[model samples]
Target: MGCSKKKIKYELSKEFQFEAAHRLIKNYSGKCINYHGHMWRVIITLHGHELDEKDMLIDFNELKPLKKWIDKYLDHTTIIWENDPMLTFFKKNNQKYFITKKSPTSEHIGEIILDKAIELFDNQRIKVKYIEVKESNTSSVKVYSNKY
Candidate 1:
């Protein structure tokens, strides 16, 4: 029994969605401004010691609640990097709405979601080992667990 618990290792992936905007600061710019959107994809990895008799760490259905909550704020919304020039322009034009203090980069977004995940789980047993964010099919970044 003791060996079983120690030998078990599993990883599960969950997908989440959020819509936002941002720009990459460039020395010479062509066209990253003009405002754009991305279909952000997040994969949350869970790691643990043992699995249930069903051979699973946790049920997939258990994630529905979190997904519902995330969808409410992330779906169809644009996120602007606070330092982006466009933000200043918008402010000068008296255009203001929902905004975040962090940059809109994939790494930044992953950190935000990871923090929320840690808060929601709040358990040392089943830990979130990594969070990977995909800005597009070709671009992605991963944030690893500090438990390293």
Candidate 2:
């Protein structure tokens, strides 16, 4: 006999935005080498095979941790390289900054967010599918996991 309970494949997403400053080092040279700030936007998507008792794949409020993570790491902060000279100026002024192991480009940031999502929600049936980081209205990068 077929199962009486209804089955649903669910997908949910949340959006977040924060302001941050960064300069790319140990890479290409361009305007990005100059300190700049962007009202960065991120979209996090989660997919699940089963819903919780509340019939929800994930509550919007429960996703707050992701936002908190971004705010703590990237918001209003300067992103720099491991031993870039800019680190001295940023520190002297006591600026909030993240010294990324790799370049802090939007593409890399997308991967960072994706990793954070996997770490943040692995216990839940809701699995992170992708993370999109937008530096501007016209430019963005997406990182996703197909295995989920």
User: In order, what lDDT does every prediction score?
Assistant: 0.70, 0.85
Work out how many backbone clashes candidate 2 has: 0
lDDT of 1 by residue, 50-140 (tens): 6767877778786676566557656665566666666676677765334557655677777777777766653656787888989899999
**How many clashes (backbone atoms < 3 Å, residues ≥3 apart in a chain or on different chains) does model 1 have?**
2
TM-scores across all candidates? 0.76, 0.89
Candidate 1, residue 105: CA error in Å? 0.5
lDDT, candidate 2, 1-148, per-residue tens: 7543346577898999999888776667988888889999999999887878898888999999999999988888887877788889889998888887788888878887899889898665778889989999999998996656
Separately for all candidates shown, the number of backbone clashes (residues 3 or more apart, or on different chains) is 2, 0
